[model samples]
Target: MRYEAHLRARALERPQHAALVCAGQRISYAALADIAERFASALVAGAGFGNGERCVLFLDNRAETAAGLFGTLRAGGMFSVINPTTKADKLAYVLNNCEASVLVTQASLLPVARAAAAQAPSVRHVVVVDAAGELAGHEVPWDEFIAAPSILDPASRGIDIDLAMLVYTSGSTGEPKGVMMTHKNIEHAATSITTYLRMSPDDVVLSVLPLAFDYGLYQLLMCVKLGATLVLEKSFAFPQKILPLLESERITGFPLVPTMAALIVQLRNFRPEWAASVKFLTNTAAALPPAHIARLRELFPQARVYSMYGMTESKRCTWLPPEELDRRPDSVGIAIPFTEAWVAGEDGKPLPPGAVGELVVRGGHVMQGYWRNPEATDKALKPGRYPWEKVLHTGDLFRMDADGFLYFVGRKDDIIKSRGEKVSPKEVENVLYALPGVREAAVVGVPDPVLGRALKAILAVEDGASIAPRDVIAHCAARLEDFMVPRLIEFRDALPKTNTGKIRRAALQAEAEGRELPGEDA
Candidate 1:
């Protein structure tokens, strides 16, 4: 089935049904489908978009963002949603990497969008939402862009194996790598995840996660697939504002990460009665501590809390059934439906139960690979047990109980998962190194209850440099995304090094994880 199938079916079957509710406006399925179809027409007639072409959506979580997304798919083109917080350089890099033909953005972000699009020769059109009448030769207003006459041919719809999305993720080497996924892959992941979550058309789910994130994107896709209602919020930063929606919207499904759960734990005025309608509460990114889990149960007494684990590569890996949570709150549960996951040692052999090893997942939900990066693709998608198959080797360490329940140990790589968003230390360090420090720079993830893994930057600057923490923060703020900026900064006279003169990153990581570094009191 196509990704936009639900929008079409819902528009026909439940025309008046509310599909999305965001920012005080409610959009019906029929309205959404019409918008998507109009957008499809616009893509073809206005931008000369073809069946394998790419469209980059750089906007916030709103009805328009949702429409632009399915519209690209409806038009048989691939789409990528960049985080609204992404800087111009990264945005431009993604545009160039995907060779996007169209970019859907807002007038407020035109400065950055224009800057990025100026550098991207592949971009043919910049569709601006809420723009004034004046426009550039290559620019078009949202209203006029969607007004194109329909010229779609149903027979031309592509097959499921065609590329459907390009989700750019943080690379280990200070760059962004696009994760490639086809329609078939997305369908499998959405189906497998929804099957275990017990989602249904009757459910009204509330999502505060960014659409740029796969976790949040699926919430929209699955809701539309089931004809369910999605109440979108910009963020969970203000729990007080979002808490009331649980009752008003009759929200049954609540998806969160460790950071949101931590925020929940900090709410003193939280009333369990406020969430009486909530049926399913899910968490991922980082497993919640047992005490936090216990507290969550008391907070959402009627809701079944599911602690899940996954990444963009697989979309989702494991989901702990709510019934089994009390028994093993620390475990991220078993492999999702229609999938196989096992732990393997360094030698690529299966590890005995209870032995920590890299998690290996074999499933149709596995991403196609990184876009334009075959070397990285080979590293992640290694040969499976069968001759013709390849499996995803999640760079994470986990141990399984004899019963097959998996418990997370730690990451095999240094990609810091902060606030449910992956932050490459190298990427952050690259920005730090360019801050005129005149010396050394390093970044590490420090264990934190709230942020999942708070980013900390350690530096040894020149003797005469007068840079302070605020100055460094300002410099990073001007360059990197907000999530990539280091929250904690410390200066040292010297940095630890190996006998070979290479900086020891692990030493700093261990210190941030609570152990003392060399020359410190043990």
Candidate 2:
């Protein structure tokens, strides 16, 4: 079923319930539904947006972002959300690549939006939110854009198989690829995830991750499907201020990545009682260090912690149940509910337990394909055992335990080759995380004449902690094999990360190779 139908159903059943809360502004189910319907009508009547057209949203985490998303879906158009921090050139690339017909953004970002829209000829209209003065000929203030009479006619123009969203990847290796997801694909994923999390109408979710990241986007989508309240925040920049807001909102569910966890664990004055209302904690993007997992449990003794693994190709692949955290803290756990995950050898045959291979997933949640990139799409989606099926071949390497729990080994390309032996960066990083005063750690291979590729460990230490390079190397030498141990150690104030909080290893590798860093401009 279409996602907007969930909002409509919730509005009919619980009109007065809070659907979204951001910056002290609360929108009720009925109000949000009405605003979305009005916006959809405006897109169709005023802007002449045709069925299956593309509407791109370039806004921060706010109530209007939600409205723009649902409205585009209701109007029978696909929607794509660009990171607000994106520059003009990359933004223009996305607009032209998708051939977007409309662009919605706030006045605060008008300069960049205007510049990008100028280069994208396909963008026929620009809807400006929070405008100050008269708009340009192609621009319309949000109020004027959504002033059309509410109409429900456009919602019936599409079927479940139609495209719903075009989520762009972070593009660490090359140009970003748009992942195409259909309504049925999204619905299945949302249903499976919420079912595993045991979500209900009374649950209040606090989201700090960017909406452009599918991990963060799903939090909003799942809450809407369950008729739960969502509290949106721009970022976790100031955790001290967010603590009180969490308490005041009585947030029950908190979603985070490893970067946020590292920041929280380092807060000197943090206390467990401050966030006692948190009923559950969920983490992905990267595996939370076992130390951080233990610390999080100490801080929120009442909350259950779920360690998950996924990529943009499939919304989610696996999640470790809270009850199993003690037994398999390192494993990403079995396949998420309603999905099947297996480790496949290079020949595409399933590997036995304890063997390392590529992770393959079979489920309806897998994306249709990458937009306008058939070569990459074919590489990712391959023939399954059945003649009619296609399964997603995740490039990540993993090993399955005897009981079927999966442990992540690094990415296939990310594996370090040193001293004629293959080494998993995650293995070395995991050891580094166990060291005292190490806040974050990343391992990459640098060119070496003798060893072929020398292992380098880049780290960020906790504030006021004394950790020298020799100390880190000595610690690794004690726990790791000689070949697996890092040959070089460098400390930085912070590791560069994607908007979703995953470390940009490719960026670090580029710096090591003395090359221009990718994504620095965009």
Candidate 3:
């Protein structure tokens, strides 16, 4: 069954149950179901999109955004959620690449959406959810469309293989490619996570991540599937306001990135009561520093802190359980049910325990392929026969322990090379973060004339802490060899981050030219 069916089942089971809570708004399961059905009907009756069609959802974290996502699923169409902060060029790329027929966005975004849609002729309809307005040459005022009666169209039936959401990811080059996730893929991801986490029906999840990111999107779906409550937020920039919400709403599940976790653990007067009722605290998007892990464990002693590893290619591969967290603090944990992780060396041979190699995943949760990009898809879905099943080649590096626990090293592309020697940026970043007064650190390889490539570290200092580049370099020198030490270091107010809260190494590399990187011990 599709995610929408799960919502309907929940509505039927408990009509009055709170399904979605965004800011001050509360939507019951029944009300949310009806709105989704009505919105789906509007697309079928008003818009000219049908089964297997795609719609672009370009709104922030609001009630309408959630409705539009589920509505597309129910209408037998794929929903592509565009990042609200997506610039015009990227937006144009996704709309044209996906051949989106309809775009559901807030009124404030109509002007930008219309501008981007102008470049993509396939987009025929633009529906605005907020302040009503008319675009020069498009259908606007989304409310007018949804007011139409719900249609019981036979085509609305969604099966397991039907596409539910088409999430696009940035390619190695320009123009992001779409990742098609069917209902079964999404359901399996949600069910497996909910089952592993042991989420209860009374759990309330505080969603501070963007729905455009699949990891964040699944939090909402899992909540609906398990009859839990979702408290949505656009961002976590304001921890002061968010801390109270977690307490007031009695949030049981909270997921965050390493950057956000660092901030929350260091907040002034941060108390256990801030997350007193929270049962689970999840970390993804980026690996958490071992120091930060200890701090979080101290703060949320009652909560089960989970460290999960995944990418857009496969919804999820492995999740480190809270039980093993203290013992194997560095491990990414065991693979989820129905999933297998085999670390292969450069020669494509499976590596034994304690040997690091490329991490590959085989499971139903893997994406079908990159949308309309056969070459890229073929590269990622490297054909591997495993008992009548295919596996996905995740470009991540990992290692397995003696007990079959997996530990993440770094991305294949993220590894820095200097003088024909490879260095893991995560290791350098972790060493920097271990130093007192260091808040966050990102390591990148920069061009060098002598060594061929040089290492650089960007440091973000903790509030009110005095730490210089020399101090950081000295700390790394004590822990690492001369080659592993960053040759150059620069202090930043904040590091550049992706929408999912991961440090963007590509962006950091682009900005590292001519600035005299910190470490050069040659």
lDDT of 1 by residue, 1-522 (tens): 777776888999999999999989999999998999889988987788889899999999989999999999988999999988888999999999999999999988888999999999999999999997677889989988998656776543688889899999998887899999998999999999989988889999999999999999999999998899999999987889898899889899999888788788888888766789998899888888888888888888888888899999999999888889879978899999999999999866789999999999999999999999999999999989889999999999999999999988878787989888889998998888898854888899988876778888899999899899999898999998888988888999988887777778878888788776554322
* Cand. 1 TM to true fold: 0.97
- Estimate TM-scores for all models: 0.97, 0.81, 0.80
Tens-digit lDDT track of model 2 for 180-258: 9999999999999998888889999999878887888998899989899999899888999786766889889999877
Candidate 2 residue-pair clash tally: 0
| Model 2: residue 260 alpha-carbon error in angstroms | 1.0
Best by lDDT: 1
> Scored by Cα lDDT, where does model 1 land?
0.89
lDDT of 2 at 277: 91
Instruction: Note the Cα lDDT for every prediction shown.
Output: 0.89, 0.86, 0.80
Cα error of candidate 3 at position 216, Å? 1.0
User: How accurate locally is residue 296 in candidate 1, as Cα lDDT from 0 to 100?
Assistant: 84
Model 3: lDDT to the true structure = 0.80
- Give one digit per residue, the lDDT tens place, for model 3 in 1-522: 677888888989988989999968899999888888888888887786688899999988888888888888888899998777665656888899999999888877776777788899999888887755345557667677788779666444668798888887655553467898888888878878888898988999999877887778888889889888999998888998888888889999998876578788688789678879988898875557778888888888888999888887788889998889879887788888777778988655689999989988888898888888998888778766545655788887888988999987655665554532346677677778889988878888776533435788888888999987788888887655455678788888998677778777666765664443343212
